[model samples]
Target: MTTLTTPTAARLAGITRTLSEWQTADWKGFLHPGDLGWNSMAGAEKSAADLRCWTADGTVVAIGMFDGEDLFRMAMDPAALDDDELARQIEADLTSGRVLPAGTVTVEARGALALRKRLRARGWNEGEPWTPLRLDLRTPVPAHPRDAALRVEEIGLDQADDWISVHWSAFKGTPPSSDDRRRLVHRWTTMATGPFAHLAHHLIGYDNTDQPVAVTTVWTAGDGRPGLIEPMGVHGAHHGNGYGTAITLAGARVLQQHSASAAVVVAENSTAGALATYLAAGFTASEPVTDLIGSVTQRHP
Candidate 1:
């Protein structure tokens, strides 16, 4: 039987660490270590509380989390993708509503999953397309990419406002609260000594006026492994100035310095401009990943 378990607060960190260990660059469109890191940094208490896992003979074979009432994000063991019994069990569990709440649910399964088709057969519609992009870091990054006019530098607590302001401007309506910022800094501080020490990088790009215009946060899975640049953005006013590419190059440089094998980022296939920015930053595009959506089949307590 496939056993399901909700890891407790004490076990959450270790669970994510194990998931990170399970991550490999070759596996595309799956749950990622940096995804866990991002959620943890954003709201550790809430994230830990929402995580769940499926085990086979006591070994965790699948990991998942609910982003709210409607969306579920998951990644399973690459080995188990071909396991018919396991995949059927997973599909049943998910649709049964024992694990997820009833709703018009959306599921993002990283990489290709066998369960995807089963969900489709059960009335799930294929959702939006997302493209993954990568930059090789095995070779030295050019000290300067062509459009390097913006001054980019690594930042810390003292310059949090610089980073936050650009982030707030980029994300306009959904900006984080003051308390969220405090927790983020605290999370960074706590990561100082672990394997995650070299994982997170915060960078800010400045315009000619010395005002922060762009920001990027890169997280390396481990030395010589793939690193991800999540939410790299340019200030609203600075959107057309090439700041996005400059900041992205800056992020890739940071990953290279930290021994990353490659730098990765994902963009929606529909976002032509954003995709163009990453391509301009020298990232190669890959096949797009699609989400699976379906209404809950039952209700869970």
Candidate 2:
């Protein structure tokens, strides 16, 4: 494997735009606009690409960022490295100041276990701290939504405020500014046509007067891999009507129509209580991956 780093000062949007496309295309929803879990190296913006690796022939293989000696989103193409090769790369990254505090990695179950084993063998054991779970799309969902009043509808940009209000009210004390909410909704609307969003359905639930009550966003990797549901939310007052489950199936139907093999689902450890909603929607857990922050090397003595 060959690693390449370029030192340049360019607009953050310009550099990260390519990285975002690369992620949306190749990395399968790993570095989304909402996830700020990456390590920053050479002071690169957290939302953009800091370092990229490619196969000898120049095809990109892995992409990551570093903050001090920590790393995050260290995804590598399996065909390019064996266990020893992987270990060597990790070590080089650690000692060379290429990675920083948030430096961590995640892969599919088998791959994650393999890397975890390699890191352990190399004395990198902080812990198995994060347990991220995924939902496979190809599986058949229960034939129906939870109820009839639970209507699933596309959230137009005009009605973005309605959706925003639900989130604002849900979070209550921590409401964002109007501009922030506008940008947030714009991104969601953009996701309706995003690379991943291109083949999927994005939906929201509404109450009797057509006000949004719940929201769930789903999309595919464009490789027929499966669909993924993210940022699923139900307003504070509408929690018990099975709104979450109904909309989840609505998205699953879209996946099933595409002949997808699985749908992926993830929730941080703090949100374990919501896992039951997914379980009730006919989703089975594949594996749970930890979501960790800070650093073992820099923070630990």
- What lDDT tens digits, residue by residue, belong to model 1 across residues 73-176? 88788788767788798888888888878878898885646788778787789888999888888886644453457888997667766677788778783556
Candidate 1 achieves a global lDDT of 0.77
Off by over 4 Å in 1: 142-147, 173-198
RMSD of every candidate to native, in Å, equals: 3.1, 6.2
1-301 in candidate 2: lDDT tens per residue? 6565532335343333333333321223244322321122113333344444433445554445432333455544545334556546654564344454434432221233345555556555443433334445545567544557777776656766666666665556355688878776665555443323344455678866676877765654444554566557778877788877777777777666766556666654456657777777876664555523332344222
Query: Global lDDT for candidate 2?
Result: 0.52
Q: Which number leads on lDDT?
A: 1
The alpha-carbon root-mean-square deviation between model 2 and the true structure, to one decimal in Å, is 6.2
Residue clash pairs of candidate 1: 29-110, 29-111, 30-110, 30-111
